[model samples]
Target chain A: MKAKPKQSRYLTLVLILGLIAACTPPAEKTAEPTSIVEADPLPSWNDGPRKEAIISFVEDVTDSASPNFIPVADRIATFDNDGTLWSEQPIYFQFFFALDRVKALAAEHPEWKNKQPYKAVLENDMPTLMQQGEHGLLEIVMSTHAGNTTDEFDSLVRSWIDTAQHPVKKRRYTELVFQPMLELLDFLRANDFKTFIVSGGGIEFMRPWVEGVYGIPKDQVVGSSIQTEYDYNNGKPIIKRLAKIDLIDDKEGKPIGINRYIGRKPVFAAGNSDGDLQMLRWTDANPLMSFQLYIHHTDSLREWAYDRDSHIGKFDIGLDEAIEKGWTVIDMQTDWKIIYPFEKNQ
Target chain B: MKAKPKQSRYLTLVLILGLIAACTPPAEKTAEPTSIVEADPLPSWNDGPRKEAIISFVEDVTDSASPNFIPVADRIATFDNDGTLWSEQPIYFQFFFALDRVKALAAEHPEWKNKQPYKAVLENDMPTLMQQGEHGLLEIVMSTHAGNTTDEFDSLVRSWIDTAQHPVKKRRYTELVFQPMLELLDFLRANDFKTFIVSGGGIEFMRPWVEGVYGIPKDQVVGSSIQTEYDYNNGKPIIKRLAKIDLIDDKEGKPIGINRYIGRKPVFAAGNSDGDLQMLRWTDANPLMSFQLYIHHTDSLREWAYDRDSHIGKFDIGLDEAIEKGWTVIDMQTDWKIIYPFEKNQ
Candidate 1:
């Protein structure tokens, strides 16, 4: 689907990781459960309104005596996967998966070394790739993401996520997640709030490994998608992925995706960019007492910090709105004692 | 979207009720718990292979020592709506909803009495209404179902469902759901199987009350949809419903819907028509020890029974496939002690 120019490149990014370790998925969803004793739900935080806001909101909503008390089933919390829950510096992670796939399959498609977008990807030229815009990105993504059975694609993501290293940070992409956010996810789940990931990344790409990394399950994660076909090859049944786009799941799409997938309005929402504006606003507009937070990536040393003029995960207009609404804007350098999960070990 | 002519009229129905009360939805989801003790997981099911097959399959898959043992997270079970879980005789309940909405809105649009499809509806003319074909039905459905805020549509359905009576059955549409299936849903939940409704009905239509009616939460429901927009209505954010079609979720679309929403193939699937053949085949195709069932509507005296030639939920090809695959064909009259929950009152 060729989207309107304004709804262009940003629409199709689909990120799908959850909890890192809940349901034993504490790796996020299934691998290693992030260990937390009952004493402190969020230990990584330095302690302030940024941290207190999360605790106070949870306490008020879960407290039956409070006027803000929301029932367990109605207590839905949505978070943007990229930047908000983890890092999306330099560029989005799924884009890396696309570029890596192009390079991996370069040997198969000999002509790709000469092709425009394919050439840009093969040479690891970010500047050239940026010029291709949404069209180029879609071409690269569809070539690698589509054209396989769902099970085959699942294994592809699983293998890649296990060994793939972040280009700049030189850390496993999963380990780059904010420790405070992970604790927040666990804290919310502990309070009977059903947490979900609403992203602009591929739904399939995220489902493969999010559980072990986020404790969020496959079903709880919603993201942008491509069309799929149910194929009956003689006797075997397989879902064949089609290159055609299904949902964009970005900007205004966040709330639309929530309605399609989650149904009820989320009382809690968190995001990091202009892309997340609609979701935060939607949460703020909920009839129930709601909480909205904007994660300000201000820690230039611990994490890449970019806003206003930055291209990837820009946080300009959303930041303005967060401040205007009196929503919590966490200044990362001042608020967090540490950033990544690996920092805790150090 | 003008669908392929073959995929026309049947593409837009969205039935959203589940375990009537599963989360307490045992009403299949919530109003009443149905008062079943742990002793009998399925009291409505008669003592036969149809019943025994369910017990054995569950025991095998849930048993840790059994070769068929599936991990708890992997225990997904999907079901078809309409005839499989509830009654779809005469026509789909959503069609009834469309008709009623048209009638309710008729006082505002006197021009409808003179219009073709709406005139056909106002006159209570089925054959004339059927003659309007898919385009006419879409016109009727879109007129009533679309153009409202999502919250408004939610309230509309809620108000209508509370008071509306089934034209023929005389009972409420929710009351027409199968007693045995409700028991089956509760049974599966007890054993750790995650049950879902994979229907061709409207996603929004089912979300509001399904948790109370089927015990399945709002997020668990997946069905056909139209486009919606996130409008900041003077800062009062609302998801505005659009008449544009989204997903059809029928036939081959069933497996596609399963992939899009649940992101996993079900180990058990049940249905009553050819529309569900792909889902049943998809479940049967699962690499696990899967179970497939076709509810053969065969008891006219107790419940309306029509099979191969029935217009609403024809069960010809699916029934033949079930028998050939050696899968269970639930003989409704013989296999069920009661067809509906109300029968228990008598």
Candidate 2:
């Protein structure tokens, strides 16, 4: 009772019923190739220079006869998740998740109502929360994200991802993912590229829903993780997620995370902020023909547009480097036909 | 120039030239799967109860209509490296690597000619080296394994693997990989299982050569690691491998490493020693159907056989658990037709 690939499943059914005529015609039907452009793979992307460059890079690496041909085994493409794949405007989506968690758990830990960061979160005071800064954010993240089995945390994230909506968008956080980026992921996979998410976000938080939303499987994700311990509770084993930080998986940590988890340099890497500069540099450093893409949020009317001046997902040095190096900078305003999938009809 | 999957390359060429005759037959020719066994995928495995069970497990998990059918993404299979996949006799093979490295490095560190561990390593003094114990081993391992950039370390391991031979076997260390295990890996992969090497060996040490020897990719390897630092050496970036221990990847740490790197519990896991107990337990704990395998070194004539009373690759607890749980146990002497690839002809 071996699991069959989709192609083989149909073939098995046809062959069992002695339907050779059924299989032959379908094979010939798919033979029409060069006469047509094989459907616009990146349909969400506008036919701009950035889109052209991205398609060209994929073609260069995949064409076996070309000088830039990369082996399929080495066709690793990494992406920064937050701003690169999904919206990180207002603040990182994970912060909202943490805030919501803090509110949910406030019932159990009533002291949160009086606590500085927790109190600020409860009152929905942004300035106060920002004043509390890194330590406060870590406190909220660790409190809600850890102190449970990985299974329990996965359940928590699944519940939140299923129910919670973006405060501004009035859509699920998963819905905030870029349609262009989703198309890009599909296009890369269609061409035999293994796409991975090397994110600064909590690995567990993304693992539960990434497969559904982005089509990136759990194991393919490389992200910031808390220290975990194997707790063999009388043979009912569980991996305990501790509050201690294990990996940051951002900036310099991105390359290190790639090395640790992937052990191969990505031929293509995409990012949005200065935090992604190191990863872009790392991908560009690959001996193979590599592509570095920077997504510039220039569409204020469609998606929030803030770059260098913004505190969250600040694009300063990486923007300068992308411009200087002539890397593909995705002008979200002009280059994207649509922002989120919800905007497709509009 | 996009990298072409072999299947598509031929199809594209035939369709472009309008050669319909060349393409039609290869499709239906492969349909006769039921009449014959698929080329005896595990050729090196003897036809015994262990082999039967292993094959049955694979068939059970892979059959699409079966209740036990695991989806391709969930079909993760992990193998312990040292004593399980290859031979780890007299001492762990990595120890041999470290000892040889110490001798090669002795001229640079002149004090090492008289040093306790280094002197012992240079003189081939096993009894004295054993006396220095874990602390001494760690010093040798760290000193030899770290301080270089990951690239440099990769080169060193590559060079060593290219030349190093097992003392007892007099064969290249890579050549000593179990023939049956290699076949098992291929069989699993052919069935769409993603195979990974989850070893206690150094991550860098395994990455450079495992792909060449075992057909397992570098990223798929989960192993013990030293802390790596991203050094942007005037824009010529390098990840410096430090002497600090980042992960142990043994015993309880095996499961922890699996969690960190894979982020999912494997449905299939194989091991030979007590150190792999936790990983096996964790895999068995998978909610989906799971298969745990223990490689019992019962072939004293062909390979060194020591299990319950052995110091290296001690198999007491794992053996008892395998027997008690009715899990698959590979008796090397009885179940394997050949030990290593070199022995295939013999």
Candidate 3:
């Protein structure tokens, strides 16, 4: 009796309700927005060395008469895309998305079960999964990312980001971006600074969402990328994506990429792990007045902390060196007022 | 008798009086006004086909709704330093500057006669000069450029440019710049384009006067350069120049330099020789709307007119190809209202 037309009608109603909710405006007001009234992400950042350092640097450098003053034209700032600007817990947000894509498309492609990386991803075996490391990750990306042009892949990523949720948090990864850092980016840009993202992530992967997430436009985002060839396919000129890595925009490669793309050394730099140490050092070595800040993940309950020896985002020697050089070190546990956006419920 | 100081002084005064009377403002405005009317350089350039083409392309790309519309942030335009925007005749301005430097400092450096390229330049021997070609040019640049830190070398170039005059035209090299191209540069920049000078000239030599001459700030000048090392000299860290050529920014090197430095294809390319051919081709290959224009030196009266076989600033194959491709070929004789600033004869 329940499996007849009544169930079909109920399904239709649910679909219409979901579409209506999607179209509805967010509850937050535009002028006096409720979102703006939320907890400050870095409330514990006292008006001491941490806060004063940034203000003094900005004021001094922006003052033309000051010996350390850098012209507004030369004020370039670079930020790491991963943990520095957004959350990278459990696994990097991209990895989680790739895993989900493999599962969702598995029914369409029955042979995925026999495939190596997709099979490993589908089974949800934790220890066995990561054993593939970068090689395994590259395989998953190539299998899913290829077979189409760059524009087609960008659409796929956009669709995934619109609906997919983080495994542990059950919230969109876009919501996991650090609100404090977003504010900082806006503040820097407001003061006539050109902010750029220099990341180890795939260039094509991050380019689609970077503008929306960080307010940094696509051209300003430099990252790892596979070699792409521009070709005419069926009278349409398309940039075809390849499976092999063309360049890795990480570590020493960071400085190379910065000099290659930016044509100027950044006066301000921020990062979260060892991968960013070279970029910080490069920024510090510039002739202009410079600032380098490293984010130290030290909170567990609030947002899960694992630094030092973490395989995914190691921050050991870099942390020690930052302290030695008197660089700004952001202690996540004590400095941040809030962690994830959902943590406000606590 | 003329060797006496008083006679030379009297002769100089007489010459000054004669020139002032001939070239100075009218009697009523001689001391009354004498205002330096900072000229627009190319005010008479009616919005013609070339101007319309450029404006339409930029407008379409910068407007978000248009299919070709790229963001203003992604609007990048690269211009060839010589011939495209300025005169490169009698000799490339940089080469002439190098020769003048060798001559002016010859009194102190008698040992230069014993050197290879210096000896070749001192004798004013054209055949031997052409024989050395690029290799000799590098030698001349290194001798004049190295042995000082970047700051000191920049000052040296600045001083030479400030006092020096072109041997043939008898005007300052900066005054020999094309008025029409200057307008084009400012026009592109006004529309939020990032314009760069991609040249074969020594980077250090171009940086000092480029800001004042072209209004292109130092950071935007990409050129051939010697290797530099960061060193602690006299308790201050500085980039010290060396004699070794790290990169040559010319011909095929031009495209490589653009790729290595800017990381994006130009939306608009303007050049004047075969050296710039590859750069224009590269820019023309952009999937987005693009424009390429070449300056053909066809006016013998207004400016030196020789192409196909001219030794300096040659325009053989590039001119033929530009005509074949139906690219806008700027006829300097007919298209321009003025050539060099001094060519006005005021």
By DockQ, who's the top model here? Answer: 1
Q: After superposition, how far is residue A141 of candidate 2 from its true place, in Å?
A: 0.9
Q: Could you tell which candidate, 2 or 3, scores higher by lDDT? A: 2
> Over the stretch B22-72, how does candidate 3's per-residue lDDT look in tens digits?
331211211111223354323534346765666677678777899887666
Candidate 2 chain B: worst-modelled 10 consecutive residues by lDDT? B1-10
* Local lDDT at B64 for model 2: 91
> Stretches of candidate 1 above 4 Å error?
A5-38, B1-5, B8-38
Per-candidate DockQ versus the true complex?
0.55, 0.31, 0.07
| Ranking of candidates on lDDT, top first | 1, 2, 3
- TM-score of each candidate structure, all chains considered together: 0.91, 0.88, 0.69
* Model 1 C-alpha lDDT per residue in residues A162-197, reported as the tens digit of each score: 999986677889988988898889999999988899
Q: Any idea how many clashes model 1 has? A: 86
- The TM-score of chain B in candidate 2 is 0.88
lDDT digits (tens) for residues B1-346 of candidate 2: 0111221111121111112112112111111112224678887787888888888999998999999999988999999998899987656677667778888888889999898878877876656766775567668878999888888888888899999887656778998899889989999999999999998788888999998899998889998888888877887778898877787787888888888888889999999888798899999999999999999988767776778856553479989999999989888878876787766444
Best model per lDDT: 1
Candidate 1: residue A180 Cα off by (Å):
1.0
Per-residue lDDT over B79-123 for candidate 1, one digit per residue giving the tens place of the 0 to 100 score: 888788887765678877888999999999999989978997798
